[model samples]
Target: MLKEQFKQLAIGVAAFTFSCATAKAATTITVAVTPTAANAIVDLVADFVNANPTYDVAVVGSSDSLSKDAIVAGGATGPYDLLLAQSYSVPANLKYYYPTLVSGDPFPFAKDTLVLYSTTVDISQGIPLQLQAFSLPDPATADPYGVAAVQALGPEYLYAQGQSLTIKTADAGGSYAQVAYLGTAYGFTGKSQICTAVTNVDQYEPGSFHHEYVLGQDYTTDIVLAGVKIARTRTVDQETALTAFVNFLVSAKATALQHHCYKLPSAQ
Candidate 1:
């Protein structure tokens, strides 16, 4: 009888322990930081997660789908607790349509700089094939960076001499990816691979490719990564899951993003 009684007590204790472990409330926050934000803020996300025991963090790539999903889904169903994106789209893309989804003010996270980087192909060596020799896409149509670049080029110069540059058009992706395409298409393969590559006359041929100035016109592109513009909300559960994830990002643990390379938007 004594042995059986002890065994029962042990079983009860184990069950209680298990229940306690599983009963704790868990919160997750998702962040859709742009490429710059990814580099800058990824570290912060880690830090935030470490400090907050009850929260989890998820980082998603920006696209229209992510933004629409974050808004349309409700907090309990397709919920996202917080979002951080570029400033340009908030009122038009997010705030303007909030009534159709959750009713509340969207939280602001950070601001960022729009910087341009490139690989091979040097313009100082010789004039570009034309004033706007490089290929790019239209900002109004789809490519935000391309739009900024065009604005930087100045319409007067670009339209000069009955010549123009090409701004290739495609669905949006990452900044490095865009730079990669620019380098590869321009025949600057090798060490000068655009984003990663830099032109060195001594390192390679004299006429190597190099990234030019990053036009400030397209600060909106940074929104692509901020989870502010896009997120994954195909289902109510997904949105809820993503929201829980984003909440963690802005929490105390998110200081890690600063260490990783993400500058606080306020730093600007």
Candidate 2:
């Protein structure tokens, strides 16, 4: 009788371990996003997990183009189950897994506008005489914002006129940081970025910066943001979770959060 009781106890323990492992596996989802939207995305994930306690989500953020490239390279079975990226790149990036996409469509999330930020207190002084350099994202590469910046600034005319506009380029986040902290005379970035800097200025070294809207005639483009989910190559449970998360992103609560951060929701 004692030997039989011990055998039953061992079986119960094995079953319990397997159940725990399976439950753990079912509760996690991975998402990739661009740096411009990282903060808002992180907040959204937190709220999502809180509302759905049974699930856990992780967010990975990088440059917009890089994030799209990584997801594309991963194909249908990539590390990420969903992608939040700039609107322009979504269609191209998800081309590989297009047929298998959750809805096979990209959902518009938000809109952003280009703006000019300057460390100088007054930008009305014609780009500041003390300004030795102008900084922006690289237009030749992956950044749509960079291309917009080039259209706004007309670099060729400035260069031809022998202006001391030392052109500097970096990713969007890097450009914002350089202007905010490194004393770059002028930097071009999204309006959301400038808003973030304004709200978080006290955390940086003592200084003042100003921002001006780059008119449509200047930038000649608009920025729209969107998100997409890859089809479930994992499990039906994961597919349901991904769909729910994507829906939440476009819901009123999430839209309000994005709006508070100076991003205009697509619905607007």
Candidate 3:
């Protein structure tokens, strides 16, 4: 009878140990996100945080600073458990930090399309009064949407234009009125940048004329609200965690992307 009791006790201890180990295995990942799309994914992250309680998020920035440079410069020292960068912004300089996944592609979370815009005054009769006159963002190092926007404007036209109306560069909070009043800025992102610019212009121009053209993918949204110009982006290293997050976003109860004016990626 004593031997039987000892065996049962040992089995109970092993079972308890296994359960504890399993519970401890669950982990939360941190994603470094740009501003344009962070709004959307943050909702999803909130749900994950609420459900799991162990996970947390730290938003980095919307554009420029605190982006690719931070990730590349800090490498593993950066605060992120995962890096969310533009498809174009992925720094070749930090190739050493990324790990290869055996079978899955980097999950695309949102998209933003850059547009060619002018203050409302620039438009008369619903057409641009300036007649093919505008400033464009620099394609080489700025936003991908901006780069593509410049390309959409055509190389010959861009080269021949003599670069007038170039808005001055300013930190993120320079106020939209300040940017538009500068008249020209070469580098820009998509909607957020333009929106900021418009806000600046509106302060001064008030009903300023603005026009926009779709530049390129700024963020990849889930399929539901995919039409919005900007969407957040993020990636995860753990396949299980990544899959769980994806599923959570798509799930009916936590349809965070759809709620945020962006669509989720189509199921594959």
lDDT per residue, candidate 3, 106-223, as tens digits? 4555444443444434432322334343444334455454345445545444553565444322221122223354443222324433332212231212444444443233222211
Tens-digit lDDT track of model 2 for 1-268: 2112222221211111011112377666777776666665666677777677666677776555565666566666666777777555655456544555434677677777776666565554334545457677666675767777777657553562377564545555556666665677767766656453324331211344545555475666666777777654667667777778777787765643453244546357
Give the per-residue lDDT digits (tens) of candidate 1, residues 1-268.
2112122221212111011111123534444443323433444555544554444555553433454564565433453444454334542456566644433445545432233333344453322543434444345554445445545456533473246344343322233334443342331111111222112111322333443333244222442223342332334643554555456554544444433323344434
lDDT of 3: 0.38
For all candidates in order, the CA lDDT equals: 0.38, 0.59, 0.38
lDDT of 2 at 172: 57
The number of the candidate with the highest lDDT is 2
TM-score of 1: 0.54
TM-score on alpha carbons, each prediction: 0.54, 0.74, 0.53
Give the range where candidate 1 is weakest over 10 consecutive residues by summed lDDT: 12-21
